[model samples]
Target: MDAKLAQIREDREELEHLLSLAQRARVKDMLSINLRKLDTEYIVTKEKLDQAQVAVTLGQASVTNTPVGRQLDANPVIKAYDTTIKTYSWDQSDKFVKVFLTGLGDLSQVSPDQIVQQFTQHSVSIRINQVGDRNLLFNIHHTGQPIDPKQSYVKVKSDMISIYLAKIERGRQWPHLRASDEVTQKPIAPPKIDETADPSAGLMSMMKQMYEEGDDEMKQTIAKAWSEGQSKNSPF
Candidate 1:
């Protein structure tokens, strides 16, 4: 049962990472649907594992007097927050913006008092106490828009923490999650093409530019496609 739960959880995490890296709208939709299915399966499997453990514990009550059983009871497994959450996702509605911070480990055993939140008119910070070896910290120095800090709040869940920011202006929409995104960086000009250059040269130049400017996942996808094309065209 433990092995089954672990496998399901691993699958769910992988699907989530792929969904984050997915580029196309169609692909994102497909991954999102499949990820949701895996999430449900993980929850069901976890419940079953818990039930099995409880049954075993009940059956072993008589053996608790033994040294081995006593030691086992004294030393429980501690799952720590070893994985740092580096990125977050946000969405907005008519009067609030919701920021989701995932990858938090096993908050079911953690108390609400252990989680601390600080909010200002335009920023928010979160700290989780006693995450085994280290404390977890998450902060947004500046929000895209002003929020009513008095009304904003955080919620801790078994898997993640969510921050709800109340929009000061009732129905106004936010342009971005962070204030930094609102300042547009200067665009890089496209590569210059000569009229006499080979038609394929122009395509190659465009691909090079994309590879230079794209994110890590985009660069990887382009490299994979280029390798497959070269392999298909090569002849011994």
Candidate 2:
């Protein structure tokens, strides 16, 4: 899974790069041609990379921490299983969420590059590879690990891998969503999903809700975010 995620990371980046080329086409014909190339490659490459990595790491240890050193000191398959067991994994609980956020199932019909573009207008767009999406889905469903409310479209978005990267970073930097806010002088409460509506619309609503209901002092605190959509910014 991790490997596939890495390749998807690569593929997503590459397709996005190509999409930029396509988007830059001045002529309508060129636009269509470039767009087609980008969309098609994104679909095919993303799937291929995702599947390829999954094939290797599925149901196994991706990285071998202590393969023959401690766990299998005298095992016959020591050499055979010496490889690391650290790879991306798809848990039964998060399988659906994984495909959903990665823009694999329903959103797959749309061009990933375009979808990513809708959020920020940065020179280079970003994508959420499967691994990070996997983690985000886990947090969403199991741990109530609130995704950043600032990521307004996260509800129906395919920008997970990157999203999790932010979540991880926030956790590392702040220890909790309760970020420091000099204005309110308090940490914000984590966000929780209330309903399952149109994923994108639901997300937008969720963000507005947070902003409206949050303590006035904390509103500014939570406003700081990683941005998605077309503005030359990385996925938040």
Which candidate's TM-score is highest? 1
Residues 1-236, candidate 2: write the lDDT tens digits: 34433543443343344333321112112222323333443455455755665555532443555564444334322111111112232221221112123333343333333333122222212332333222111121111122333332433333322222223124233222211111233333334444334333443554466557755432443343212233445453
Note the clash tally of each candidate. 0, 27
TM values, all candidates: 0.44, 0.22
Assess candidate 2 and give its lDDT.
0.32
Off by over 4 Å in 1: 1-84, 186-236
**For model 1, what is the error of residue 76's alpha carbon versus the real structure, in angstroms, after optimal superposition?**
15
lDDT of 1: 0.64
* Segments of candidate 2 deviating more than 4 angstroms: 1-26, 59-118, 121-236
lDDT at position 121, candidate 1: 79
